[model samples]
Target: MKNTVCLIAAASFLCSCGGITERPIGVIYTNAADPIAATASGGSRTGTAEATSYLGLVAVGDSSIEAAKKNGGITSVSSVDTHRKNILGVVTTYTTTVKGN
Candidate 1:
């Protein structure tokens, strides 16, 4: 019975270690133009569209960051908008993992 309990506790601890954790590395903001200009043979017309901006919270394990640096720099980024209220516009939390060469 004691042996079984110890084995169960060890398994539980190992499982917990793989659980998700948040670690903020950096933040980024992006501004993009909407309603691209249209051109015709007669002339061209440009219409101003409302500017959209976003804030991203980048996070990754410390080991992942070190591995990524070896490749060069950040190659790809994936983000999702939660539309949370914060000092930054349209606050969003992001989870990212790095890929190394």
Candidate 2:
């Protein structure tokens, strides 16, 4: 019985030490043109689409965000304009880990 308890405790300690916490990645931004100007500015439309794509991949109000903040990660917030006259904003945070050579 004692041996089993000792083994369990050791395993728990090892698991705790081996855990890796989730971290933030980065923020993204995009800008689009007004309906009348979109036709004139292809670049703006593209930028707006790019920003939308990036925002789609972000997870907001997740526990990971809190964890990253607690771990000293960098946070960024941005705004994007869409071709449809819509504006979107998002905030992202990132945590970095360095592997030894």
Candidate 3:
């Protein structure tokens, strides 16, 4: 019984995988010389967008900058970040976040 339980645990561990992944898509350097430019020094604001898909086939939607902008309520951004949460590589949640003034 002990050996059987150990084998099952090993199999389950090998078969299951889940975690969070983050990626940077772009970055902007804010300069004091340009008022219109996105500056790194300012009130920090964040916008997040989410996308959902099934089996990597049929997809409902995807995260976009426009969505992020709407969420964050900002005109420009200094940097963009992405995150993915997956369950058994079947269902995935894609997220996009932006930071700026």
Candidate 4:
């Protein structure tokens, strides 16, 4: 019984080490456009979207563009920034931010 308990404890510790973490991967742009032209026409705005899941893989949607469009008068989206975070391979969160005119 003691050996079994020790084995279980070690396994648990190893599993705990296989957890998710968060980092800013990079910036992704759908298209190439003049920076000044992109922000000049309709003014500046930002849209953010986040998704979270527990005990499962969560797929987050890119709602930044839709969010910006909701504000009205958004001519174009300049950039999309994404961040990912996970907890012990059980929970995860994804945040997407869009900036544009």
The prediction achieving the highest lDDT against the true structure is 3
Please give each candidate's TM-score. Answer: 0.19, 0.19, 0.55, 0.45
Better candidate by lDDT, 3 or 4: 3
CA shift at 89, candidate 3, in angstroms?
2.3
Q: In model 3, what is the error at residue 99, expressed in angstroms?
A: 1.2
On TM-score, the stronger of 3 and 4 is 3
- Candidate 3 structure lDDT: 0.61
lDDT of 2 by residue, 1-101 (tens): 99999999887654523344332121223232322111222221111111122244764332233333333332331222223112233433222221111
Task: Give the poorly placed runs of model 1, Cα more than 4 Å off.
Answer: 16-101
lDDT of 4 by residue, 7-49 (tens): 9988765553334323222122111112212333433677666
Candidate 4 clashes: the total is 0
Error of 1 at 85 (Å): 26
Task: Name the regions of candidate 3 deviating beyond 4 angstroms.
Answer: 1-39
Residue-level lDDT for 25 in candidate 1: 19
Q: Can you write out model 3's per-residue Cα lDDT over 21-68, one digit (the tens) per residue?
A: 132211121111112234566547888787887776866765886788
Q: Which pairs clash (backbone N, Cα, C closer than 3 Å) in model 3? A: 30-39
Candidate maximizing TM-score? 3
lDDT of 4: 0.52
**Candidate lDDT values, in order:** 0.31, 0.30, 0.61, 0.52
